[model samples]
Target: MLSEQPYPVGTRVVVQGKRGPEVAKVRGEATVPEPQARYGAVLRAATPEDLTRWEDLHRQGEDLKWLLRARARERQLPVKLVAVEFTLDESLVTVSYSAEDRIELSSLIGELRKHTRARVNFAAIGPREQAQMIGTLGACGRENCSSTHLQDFAPVSIRMARDQQLPLNPEKLSGPCGRLLCCLQFEHTQYVDLLKDLPRKNAKVCHEGSGACGKVTKLHPLSGTVDVHTDQGMLLGIPASELKRLPDAPAPKPKRDQPEA
Candidate 1:
């Protein structure tokens, strides 16, 4: 997959813009196309010169941010300028921003082009992209997953939460971007590995209490105990093997947490 490709190092290019060209340091090689369309080419490697140019461009971006904020206020719109990225060729400048709804940005783009004397391009991004630009700490007590080593995003679902027995509250399960936690993908494999040896949740088990079969309620792998709820609503603990796998039991949920892919 393109996402799995390793990037090369030490390539430098100027991203062109209407105002002027800005330089960016390639942080890593591009394995996949950036989710947005502003990027023209796959990222290669970064050089020291590229880093220096990137810093300059970042400063310019900050200045542009202030200008955009003032413009947004003047235009009576709720919009935020997230970032300014220069093309590798230094011929085009792309301005990435976010707004609740589309606004007529042609005038704004024209104004920027006139002021900077470079081709100006505008891009709209989501809150997730905004978080990536600003960067933040994650639940793991480290840099955010998007800003750090995570190169690709995997689909995360509520089923992952149910599998891990995690709280369903949005705030607890979501990241700074108000999306499902990225860490859910980290430990998924462990759960899958352990589940291979366990009985299904709804399987029938031998109950020592009334000498009758009971529905399996839960399995405690570490203690090797399986709790079964009998027909009479009584809970009984028995060895894991005492229960038989039921044809009707729902398939065990996929492991939602793994350290690495």
Candidate 2:
């Protein structure tokens, strides 16, 4: 498989064991630490001949990307081409695109097959994959996570920001994918775990050292402290370690059933 291909991390390779040999770049140790079984195996590292062929294909591929876009526009197809790839043997030309709806591309494929004289394949992608192909600097000014380290896209949502107590602003929260930042999923579990033993909001609790009973008003997971709204109508910052949970008030004894008069 592509991951198990024992060529160097960044080596250009011709993948074997498919309908036709596919050319793939070594994603390498940084992105894929462990080689996962992909669609193809490392047939061989690219030789001068292979590189020459790829160079030729590369030029044509770039043109194909634009040609597909142009053709789509000419035909009024509501799709935009994002990328194009040619297998080492020219057996397949994979074209990636973005579209709101499934715009039929059969006629487009017919034209591409004629133009490139290769088997053509179409792939529709979401904003996340679009970001992966067209990488951008993140808000942190680093390479986009999905494009660099994170290979698979994990679902991100606003709830993750809420769990981490981050400001709910779109500009700050969104990534190049125009979705909640991927970093939220990375740290969310730690925040959730830290909150498990902590008192809930408005929970009646007592500080063991001071013996003060109050309702929990605020929480600081990182600091392991929470501000308590004391019965005295004052806020007291209490450490979770020194807080003793009070048992629920016992239900009053059920009133004795009275015989009907």
Candidate 3:
């Protein structure tokens, strides 16, 4: 959101939120005054009254979360609560949750409505969104990118790991969200470009440095290296730049079909 008056980061200001006008904290500003299509202007700095109301609503949201959990437990539902948000005017309450399987929440919503004057709304969120909302440190030791600056999660895949010559271990590959790390998509295009000219696995190639013929075994995309199992039964790690495909090597295979995103 853009503010009419410049405000430092952490300043509380009122802005139009999805539900209605609400108080939000400033996180950053553009150094350049770039035009943006979706920018919403900040109405004004939050007054003391607005801050007080926001704080009260936050406490109420916490209580509502507790009540929601208790109710779900009583009904034996598998919902894992994520967050509860009340509109600034307390006209609506949005409850977000995650579940492994589909659940019928009509009865649950009806029961929750009795405890609050605001209209009750239940929102379903995925594992990735849940992690973003909960916030946690990633394997990198920094805060999870999804929870920090990433506005949207990019599509990550096992193929990305494979292209980058990463181990296929699930524990090493999965992030806190239990999904493939978002970092996998970061350098995937560069890896793909670098590997495009390299010989595929199992192809016959000659190491120029040693004049030894070998079968390509593995690729290290970032380092531009290939692992080879020589015909002499010796293993060698040679730079792709130092190797050439053998004349007798079979024709390169067609590109594998990609799965839908």
TM-score of each: 0.67, 0.78, 0.78
Better of 2 and 3 by lDDT: 3
Q: Compared with the true structure, what per-residue lDDT tens digits does model 1 show for residues 117-208?
A: 65778888776667776899877788787775454567888877665546689988999988998888777667566666677677765644
Candidate models: Cα lDDT each: 0.66, 0.79, 0.83
Candidate 2 lDDT, 42-123, residue by residue in tens? 6777788988998898898898888878888899988888988787778788888888887888978876866678777888
In candidate 2, how many Å is residue 215 off? 2.9
Two-way lDDT contest, 1 vs 2, winner? 2
Which candidate do you rate higher for lDDT, 1 or 3? 3
Error of 2 at 33 (Å): 6.7
Worst 10 residues of 3 by lDDT: 31-40
In candidate 2 the C-alpha lDDT for residue 122 amounts to 86
- Candidate 2 residue spans exceeding 4 A from truth: 1-45, 247-261
Per-residue CA lDDT of model 3 for 124-177, tens digit only, reads 988889888789899989999887656567789899999988889999999998
Q: What is the C-alpha RMSD of each candidate to the true structure, in Å?
A: 10.4, 5.3, 6.3
State in Å the error of residue 12, model 3: 3.6
lDDT score for residue 187 of model 2 = 87
For candidate 1, the per-residue lDDT at 56 reads: 71
Query: What TM-score does prediction 2 earn?
Result: 0.78
